[model samples]
Target chain A: MLRVKNLTVDHGAIRALHGVSISIEKGQLAAVIGANGAGKTTLLRTLSGLNKATDGSATWGDLNVLHSKPESLVRHGISHVSEGKSVIPELTVSENLDLGALWRRNRKESAQSKNEVVELFPRLGERLSQRADSLSGGERQMLAIGRSMMSKPQLLLLDEPSLGLAPLVVEQIFQSIRDLTNSLGLTVILVEQNAIGALKIADIGIVLNLGSIAATGSAAALRDDPAVRAAYLGF
Target chain B: MFEFVNTLLIGITAGSIYSLMAIAIVLVWRSTRVVNFAAGGIALASTFVGSTILEITGSFWIALPVAMLAGAALSAFIEYFFLRPLLKRSGDKNQEIFLPIIATLGILGIMKAVLHFIYGEKIGVLSPPLSDKGFIVSGESIALSPLRLLILGIVLLLMIALTLIFQRTNIGLSLRAASFAPEISRLSGIRVDLVRTVGWAISGAAGATAGILQTVNGSGAVTPEAFEFSLLLVFGFVAAVIGGIESLVGAVVGGLTLGIILAIILMYLGSSLVFFAAFLILILVLLLRPNGIIGVKGGRRA
Candidate 1:
């Protein structure tokens, strides 16, 4: 389980995340939907240790994740895929995936994990040697997710996976995320502006109006809610 | 024809040493977005250590490794103590690099002063370990000396070793990742700071080798105010710029090209025009390819 309580963060002088809290169960997909400047990305950054939490605490198992370094979070099986298409531009698709597995010392286990990642995003298998800059936006996102998965993490913190991607590509990528969560017991806290598509596959939905959560419920309930739909779902 | 061949041979040897130095400069730049003017100072210091070791032990074998270790240590210390804090203070997204560049210049000056303080008016020799007597080429005894051959061999071995390390190792993968994307790399469990330090240390070793080779290849003497040592840094930087300053292979190519051309100029033109010619070549290459000969807009840089 991954938990955040009263977590706060600042991007420069702006309070991007203000005392927000959320909980994600094992093997569950939690979609965090918000308008621009709603602190969705800040929440993930704080959880992943990229941004420090000024107040409150976050936990993944026994780790006090609020002040931990980013690398420590990965060691505890919590991998974070940052905002946008996050593949290393200079590294090949395969090398980017290999970087995710850098901390893994076991050669056989690393190789097996790599195989699983390629299988999950098989398009990556065909373009293994291509530079990540050559990857289309959607494929780059898949490559990002696949690279993060190379660590075989139990909890994955993903920021805006569907941003700048075609609907068809989004569908394929989200399907893979859903499948991974369902099959491998992987947990995901996906931050996205595309609420409807993300909520479709997510088990729980958390809506942020500004810096704090305005609503949290089952995905269907949030999807059906009039206010959330009018504001976020665009339906 | 024999004179031309000799000049080319000498050029190749000198270019090989510059390639090592250029590689050092490129490594430092790729790891930290700082152009280290201090690399040459570190090289001079390492060469001094080698000279001392030679005097003490009377063996080039022990002296070389010791100098490399000294270089690595000094570079790591500079990265940790000086560059890290300096970078942190000015490393905001819109961080201007002029301050860092100036800071490195100050470091180079300070290091040179310190070396002068320690070894005032003293001259130390880095006598070649191998015979410097050139093998006879058509009975003319051309410029391909055995010691020059040794320098070439060591440089080739290091380059090949570096290639293998960068391409075939986990640490290498982490180093590449860290340099490419520190945030993503950190999230992927790479200690980017430590990797940067390692990168500097490796550069230090390269600089040390270049220093030792260049000294022995020339007057075989190192002094606190050695003009050749300062020139090594300048030429190395020039070579790096020519190669596009972002690629190791480019650095090697640039170094060799610079060496060959400089040799040709010294022979055909004049010795005084060597530095002027280097500046010209750098300007011409930069004008033609702003990125460099092997420089690409994106990809693994070093």
Candidate 2:
């Protein structure tokens, strides 16, 4: 289980995340939905050790997630896939995947992880030898998620995985995110601007507005909330 | 015809050394986004170590590797204790590059001053390991010699080894990934700071090789303020820029191109025209391509 309390993050003088708090259970999928600049990415980045929190405490089990380095967090079974197509463009898909498991010493387990990633995203399997720059945006997103999976993290933090991707591709990626939680029993904190799609697949949804959590409930309840639908979901 | 062939051979030998120096510059640039002007100082200091080793062991073979190791240590130290903090404080903006370059120049000055303080009035001799006498071809003595051949062979081998490391090894992959996307690499569990240090170490080794070779290839002597070392720095930087300052292959091409053309100019025109010719060639290429010969269009700045 992962717990964050009273998390406040500042970008220089302006506060990005103001006293935000959320909890996620192991194997549960939590979606953080918000409009642009509502601290969606900031929240995720803080948890992943990319952003420093001005005042907050986050813990994954007994480990202090706030103080640990990003690389240390990966070893402790937390992986972050940042916004945009994050794979190294010059490296081949195979090489990028190998880099994800670079710290993993067991060759057999690493190979197994690679096979699992390939199975999850078959397009990546076909383009293993191709440089990532040649990959389409959708394929690059798939590679990003696949590369994160290579670390075999217990908790995965994904920021806007469906951004700019086609509807069909976005649907496919969302389904994979759902499958990761279901099949692998991995906890996920997915930040997205596509509230409806994210809410549909999420078990729990947190609606963020103006850097504060406006609502948090079961995904179904949030989907049924009239205010959330009008304001964020745009129903 | 014989004179032309001899000039070509001489140019190639000199070019190969410049390629190693250019490679050193490229490696540091790619990893840290800093144009390391201190590379020449690192090379000079390491070559001095080689000279000492040669004096002790009486073997050029032993001196060379020891100098490389010393170079690697010094380069890594600078990256860790100096460049890392400076970069962190300044941030990664492209416009902010000048400060780091200036910082490196300061380091270069300090290194030279320290060398002068330590080895003042003492010259380090680095005579050729093998015979410098030109190999006899037909009825003539060609410019190619055992020492020249050895230099070419070593450069080729290092290039091959570097290629294999980048292609086949995990460490090399991390180095590439860290340079390309440091944040992403860190998220992927790579220690980017450590990888940057490794890149500097490799660059140091290459620079040390260039320094030792330049010394032996010329007057076989080194001082704290050697004109030959200054020439190496200038030509190497020009070679890297001409090759686009990004790719290792581009460095080799740039080095060879600069070397051959300069040699030809020296032979046919005059020694005084060589520097002017280098600048003219660089201007011509930049006007034509804007990027070095093998540099990609709109490549990643970091």
Candidate 3:
């Protein structure tokens, strides 16, 4: 299980996150939906140790991960697929996947893990020798997710996975997410600006407004909530 | 035509040496986004130490590694103490892009002064105590000394080896990823700072090797009559630029081409035009191909 307790992040004098608290049980898909500048990315970055928490702590099980180095976070089995196509563009697809499994000491295990990643994302398999930059938008996202999975993380923090994708591609990605969670029992913290899509797929949904959580419930309840419908869902 | 062939072989050999030096520059540039102007300075320092060691011990084995180690340590210290602090202030528009360049020049001055303090003002010769023999082909003898041949062979091996590490190794993958996007690399569990340090150290090693080789060739030395060390740096800079600053091949090819051109030009313009010829060729290459002959636009840092 992952726990974020009263987490507050300040960028100099600017307060991006204010005393926000959240928790996720193992193998649950939790969504944090917000408008622009609502601190969704900040929350995930803080969780992943990219951003320093001004106050409070993030605990994965008994370990305090607040001040942990980003590299250590991978050993702890927490991987973040960042915003933008963060794939190493110069690295071949196989090389990029190999990097994702860098922490694993055993060469045989790492190779096995890579094969698993290729199996999960067949598009990556066909283009193993191609550079990451040559891939299209949808393919890049798949590669990014596949790269993250190369480490076999206990919890995957995905930020804006569906950004700038066509509707059909988005559907395919969401389906893959569903299948991954079902087959792998992978816990996920999905941050998205596409509120409706996120709410639809999330096991639990938390609506964030202005750097604070405004609402939290089951995904269905948030989808049915009248205020959420009026303000965000375009009902 | 026979003279041309001989010159071409010599040029290629010299170019190969320059390529080694350029690879170091490119490595540092790719990782830290800083072109080390003090590259020659660091190399000179290592060569000085190596030469001093050799003068006392007369052992090539001990001196060579000691020089490389000194270069590695110096490069690491420079990156950690000097450059790391500047990373925070990197985006300042007022500072201009040339600040790092100028700062490196300051480092160069400091390095020269330190070298003078430790080694004194005397120009020292470095003899590897090896066979200074050349192979004869078609009644023409090539000055293929064992040390020179060894140096050329080492450069080729190092280039191939480094390329494999970058492409196939896990750490190399992390390095490539980090150079592309630091934040994302951090998220993926890569120690970005460590990768940069390794890059710098490796580059320093190349510079050190180049300095030692030049000294042995009698082209790099410090003396009252001539400061060959300074000229070697100029040659290295020209080579780096000619190879397109970012291309490893460019650095080597540039160096060889420059050497051949200068050698031929020397026949006409005398020794005074060597530096001028090197820079002239470099400027021409830059004007013709801004990225260099083998330079990749935006991949692998260099």
Candidate 4:
């Protein structure tokens, strides 16, 4: 399980995330939905150790992850797939996947992880020799998620994986996300602007507005809640 | 035809050294976003050590490796002490433009003074194995001076080896990623500091190697004034910029093309007009294709 307590992040006096608290059980799929600058990304970045928390603590399995480095986070079973694809454009698709396993304690285990990822995303296996920049939007997102999985993280933090992708491609990606969580028993914390799509796929949904959590519940309850529909779900 | 073939071989040997320096410049630029103007200064320092130490021991081979090691150490030290602090303070705005460049200039002055202080103001000679030798190739006299050929072969092998390392090794992949986008590399578990350190070390080693070859090839001597060889650095920089700072192969092509052009100019015009000839070609190339012959169209800003 992962626990975040009273987390606050201030970027030069402008608060990006308020004193928010959240927790996730092992192997759960949770989604945070919001508009741009609503602190959805900030929450995940802070949780992943990419951003410093001004106050509060992030604990993963009794470890205070707040003070941990981003690299160390992966070893502790948390992987962050950053905003905007973040693939090293010049590297071949296979090399990008290889990088995700850079910190793996053992080479053979990491190689196995890579094989598993390639199996999950077979398109990646077919295009392993090609540079990542040549991939289309949907392909790049698959590569990003696939790369993150190469670390064999128990918790995957995906930031805006659907951005800049077409609707059909988005559907395919969300389906893959669902498949990954169900088959691999991987926990996920997905941040997205596609509230409806994210909520449909997520087991639990949290609505964030102006850096604060406005509502939280099961995906069905949030979809049925009139206030949430008016404010975020676009009822 | 024989004269042309001989010049081509001579040009190839000289071009290889330039390619080494140019590739180093590109490596540093790719990782740190700094042009590393101090490259020449550090190389001069190392060359000074190699020449002086070799004169004492009468062994060029031993002196060369030690000099390269000294160069790598100096580069690593500079990165840790000087560059790291400035990078910390600058914080992403191109504000770091002048700090290291200026600090490096000061280092240059200090190194020049030190050379003068230790070796005195006179040019000191270094005798390598191929000081005055030649090999016959294709019924013509080709100067296969062992030192010159060794320098060329070593540089080529190093280039190939580094390319493989960058493409095949994990550290190399991480360095390439960091060079492209540091924040992403850091997030992916790469130690940005260590990668940057390796970059500086490699740059220093290459620069030192170039300096030693240059010192031995012409005049067989080095002086405090010999350290004033910014022309080579500038030529290498031009090649790097033209080659698309991100492309290793581009650096090699740029170096050879630039070297051949300079040599041809020197062959036609007198030695005094060499600089003028170089400037003319540089101006022409810049006017025609400013980003360089092999530089990427729009991606990186090296």
Candidate 5:
């Protein structure tokens, strides 16, 4: 289980994530939907140790992840795939996937993880020799998620995976996310601007407005909620 | 035909050394976004260490590896003490690359002064380990000597090793990932700081090899104020720039092109035109392909 309480983050004086609180059970898929600059990315970055939390208590299986090094977070079975398709463009697709398992001491285990990720995204299996830069937007995002899975994370955080991708591509990516949570028993915290799509695939939905949580409920209830639909879902 | 062949031999021999230096420059640039002007200075210092080792052990082979080790240590120290802070302060801006370039130039000046202070009275000698007598072909001697062949072999081995490291290793992936996208790499759990230091170490070792080769290949001596060392720095940078300064393969091609042209110029146009011809070649290439011969087009300022 993951727990975040009274989390406040100030990005060089402009407070980004307010004193927000949330709890997520293991294997649960939690989608965070918000407007631009509503601190959705900030929340995930802080959770992943990319941003310093001014005040917060985030406990992941009894570990205080606040202010820890980003590398340390992955060791504790947590991984964050931030905004944009974040694969190393200069490296070949195989090399990029290899890096995700770098910290693991057991080479055989990382190889197993690589096999799993490749099984999940078979396109990566075909493009192993090609450079990551040659990948299309959808393919790059797939590589990014595939890389995160290479770490064999118990909990994964994704930000704007559907950004700039076509509707068909977005559906395919969200389907993978669904499969990850349902079959692999992986917990997920997804931050998205595509509220409707994210909510449709999500198990629970949390809405953020101006760096504060506006609503939280089951994905169906939040999708049906008139206030959430009027503001975020575009009812 | 003999004259042309001799000229080609001379160019290839000299170009291989320049390629070593250019590889060092490119490695440093790719890893830290700094041109590493101090490379020349550090190499000079490492040569002095090589000279000391040569005196103690009386073996060129032993001196060489020690010098390379000294280079790696000094390079890592500079990265940890100097470049890391400067980069963190500067961030990854195209314009900010100039800051480190200038900072490295300042470091170069300091290293020159320090080497002069330590070894000003007597210059260090690095005699060729192998015979310099050119191989005979059809009753005429060509420019290809055993020493030059040895130099070529060493450079080839290093390049091959580098290729393997970058293409087939995990550390290479981390270095590439960290350089290309630090925030993402850090998120992916790569120790970017440690990787940057390692990159500098590799660059330093390459620079040290260039220094030893450049010293023995020519007058067989090194001085803190030697104009030859400065020429190495300049030509290496020019070669790296010509190669597009981003890719290792580019560095090799640029070095060979610069070297062959200059050698040919010296053969026909006089030694005076060699430097002038180099400048002209650099200008022509840059004007034609601003990004370099093999540099990526429209990429970040590499």
Candidate 6:
């Protein structure tokens, strides 16, 4: 389980995340829905060691998530996919995937992981030799998710995976993410602005407002809640 | 006709050395987004080390590799101790490269001052390892010499090795990925900082090779304030820019083009016109393709 307690983060003098806390159990898909500047990205970045927290304690299993560096976190099976498209555009699809497994020294295991990633996103397999920039927006998102899987992470933190993507493509990506959690038993903390779509697939939902959690419950309960719908889910 | 062929050969020989220097500059720029004006100083310092090694062992072979290693060490040191903190503190903003450029210029001055203090008006001799006498072709001594051939061979080999490393090796993948996107590379578990240092080391080695070759290819001696070294740095920078600063292949093309054109100008036009010709050529190329010959259009700056 990943547990965060009173995580406080500052952007210069301004507090981006204020005494926020959330927990995600293993194999559970948790969606963090919030408006712009709600500190969703900052929260994920702090968890992945990209942003420094002013005061916080976060633990992923036995590992102290706050103390670890971003690179070290990946080694400990915590992979983060940043907002928008995160794949290296200059690198070919295959090369990008290889990079995802860079810290994995065992050749056999790395190859097996590559195979699994390719199987999960067959579109990626077809475009393996092509440069990532040449891929479509949806395809780039798939490649990013598939590349993250190459690390075989126990906890995947995705920031705005559905941002700027078509609704049909977003459905496909959400379905794939759901499958990842369901079949692979991967724990996920998905940060999104698309509240309704994210809550539809997430097992648990946390609504963030102005850097603090406004509501947390099962995805169905949060979706059905009148207050959450009116404020965030937009009916 | 014979004079034309000889000039072409000489141009190619000189251009090959410039290509190494250009490659060095390009590597450092891509990795750190700094033009590394101190590249010339690194080369000069390492060449002095090679000269000292030569004095001790009397073996050019031993001196060359040692100098390359010393260059690599110095470059890595500067990147680690100086540029890394400075860049971090300033934030990795590409538009703010002006500061790094000014900072590198300061480093260049410091390096030259240090070298001057150490050497103290003493000249370091880096005589050609192989025979400098041109080959006899139809009873005429052409400009192509054994030492020039060796220089060409070494430059070609280094280029090939670099290409293979960037294309085939995992470390190369990290280097490419880190330069392209440091945050994403870190997420992929690659130590972006270490990879950047490695890039600097390679660039230093390349610059060292160029320095040693330039000395041997020209006056066979170097001083702390050698004008030739300054010229090498300027020409290399120009070459890198002409080749589209981002691509390795562009560096080679830029270097060769600069060398050959300068040679032709020196031979037919006049020696005085050579320096100005470099800028004129650059402006012309930029006019045609603002991104340089091999640079991407509307690409991300730095």
Top candidate when judged by TM-score against the true structure: 2
Please provide, for model 4 over A78-173, each residue's C-alpha lDDT reduced to its tens digit, 9 standing for 90 to 100.
Answer: 889999997888888998888888877478987898889888888999999999989988889999998888878888899989999999999999
Instruction: State each candidate's clash count.
Output: 2, 1, 5, 1, 0, 0
- Considering the two chains of model 4, state its CAPRI-style docking category: medium
- Model 2's chain B TM-score? 0.96
Q: Which candidate leads in lDDT? A: 2
Question: Can you list each candidate's DockQ?
Answer: 0.79, 0.71, 0.57, 0.53, 0.66, 0.68
Of models 2 and 3, which has the larger TM-score? 2
Q: What is the DockQ of candidate 5?
A: 0.66
Cα lDDT, model 6, residue B300:
40
lDDT (Cα, tens digit) per residue for candidate 1, span A7-53:
88887788888888888888889999999999888888888888887
TM-score of each: 0.97, 0.98, 0.91, 0.94, 0.96, 0.97
Q: Give the per-residue lDDT digits (tens) of candidate 3, residues B1-302.
A: 76666566565566666666776787777778786878878888888788778878888778888998998889888988888777757767545356777778888889888767765767665775566566777777765657567777777877787778876777767666777777767777778889889878888988888777766666534432236556666777777777777655567776777777776776556778877777777777778866666666643332
Model 2 CA lDDT for position B139: 78
Docking verdict class for candidate 3: medium
Write the residue-wise lDDT of candidate 1 on B179-246 in tens digits: 77889999888989999999999999999999999999999999988999988998999889888888
Model 3, position A193, has a per-residue lDDT of 81
The reply for model 6, stretches above 4 Å from the true place, is B91-96, B283-288, B300-302
Candidate 2: list runs displaced more than 4 Å.
B91-95, B300-302
What lDDT score is found at residue A208 in candidate 2?
89
Candidate 6, residues A1-235, lDDT tens digits: the string is 9999999999998999999989889999999998999999999999999999999799999999998889999999999999988999889999999999988977798899989988989999999999999999999999998889999899999999998899999999999999999998999999999999999999999988999999999999999999999999887
Candidate 4 collision pairs:
B244-B295
Tens digits of per-residue lDDT for model 4 on B1-302? 66666666667777777787788788777778777877887888888888878978889888888888988899888888888888879865657886777776777788778877887866766666564576766565575666768778778878878878887888888888888877667667777889999988988888888888776766677777763357667777777766766667878887888777666656666578866766776677678766678665676532
